[model samples]
Target: MTKHTGAWSGTVAKKSRAAFDGSNLYRRLAVRLDDGTTIDVEVGRALWRELEVGDRLVQDEGGTPHRGQSSTA
Candidate 1:
């Protein structure tokens, strides 16, 4: 598998229900990258709860996503 490293900033454009595995629901986020390209990221229910449409997201190269602070000053 290809590993992505470093931090990337983007906006959560949309979300969708990915799968239901017995107890947990897997969710996918469509993030619009800073450059205008979009990427689909699958995350667990816990992480999914923290994300919302239009929220700024910071994803580490390790594929971990976090809620990012606003860039507007």
Candidate 2:
């Protein structure tokens, strides 16, 4: 798949849920965009480890598409 390029700024709204299946830990992050929209994201364990309640994310847009990582979490 082709990748898009852009970055967004948002605050961590909440930590949704952290789930693990035999092999990996998928973490859910709820972030609030500057406009006040809340979005949830499914992050790989590695990336999730780097995030926290207030830490910011500077991710590649293609890495997580369904969650609209381009503009929010």
Candidate 3:
């Protein structure tokens, strides 16, 4: 996979967590970007808690994913 350059903006498709060793203890917030191409991004627990499906997500080059102006808003 190549490093993402510039910026990418899209809607949050879904939220998920990884389960390891049959234990959900290793849980982490994950989301699949619904841009033209699918991309998986790890989001912080704090931010994740505030995110909901369909929210706008934007990340710039060498930047972090953040909640953008929601279309619904």
Candidate 4:
């Protein structure tokens, strides 16, 4: 896993699940950042289930990932 700090906001490019050990899985989002860079951020299952491709997402400083402007609730 990579260490992501500061604030990052982006559009959801895609969703995926990764398996390392046979017994565990991790959900992730391939986000296209506002600056045009793509990043894969791991997320909780519940939240992962709630998002879709093209959805706008933002993670403010010291906050959790959530819907952003132009995204429907």
Best by TM-score: 4
Clashes of 2: 0
What lDDT tens digits, residue by residue, belong to model 2 across residues 1-73? 1222444457676775533566755577776766677667666666666666876554445455223243343
TM-score of each: 0.76, 0.56, 0.68, 0.86
Predicted structure 1, TM vs. truth: 0.76
Candidate 4 contains a number of clashing pairs equal to 0
Ranking by lDDT: 4, 1, 3, 2
The positional error of residue 32 in candidate 3, measured at the CA in angstroms, is: 6.4
2 or 3, which is superior by lDDT? 3
Candidate 1 least-lDDT 10 residues: 1-10
lDDT of model number 2: 0.57
Model 3, 1-73: lDDT tens digits are: 2445568888777777665567643323333455466666777777788888878788888898888886663
Q: Model 2 segments beyond 4 Å from truth?
A: 1-7, 18-25, 59-73
- Alpha-carbon lDDT of model 4: 0.87
Residue 53 in candidate 2, Cα distance off native in Å: 0.4
**Residue 1 error, candidate 2, Å:** 20
What tens digits encode model 4's per-residue C-alpha lDDT throughout 16-71? Answer: 99787778898999999989999988899898998999988898887878878864
Instruction: Give a tens-digit lDDT track for model 1, residues 1-73.
Output: 2333567889999988843767766688888989998888776788788888998988876668888997887
Alpha carbon lDDT of each predicted model: 0.80, 0.57, 0.68, 0.87
Backbone clash count for every predicted candidate, in the order shown? 1, 0, 0, 0
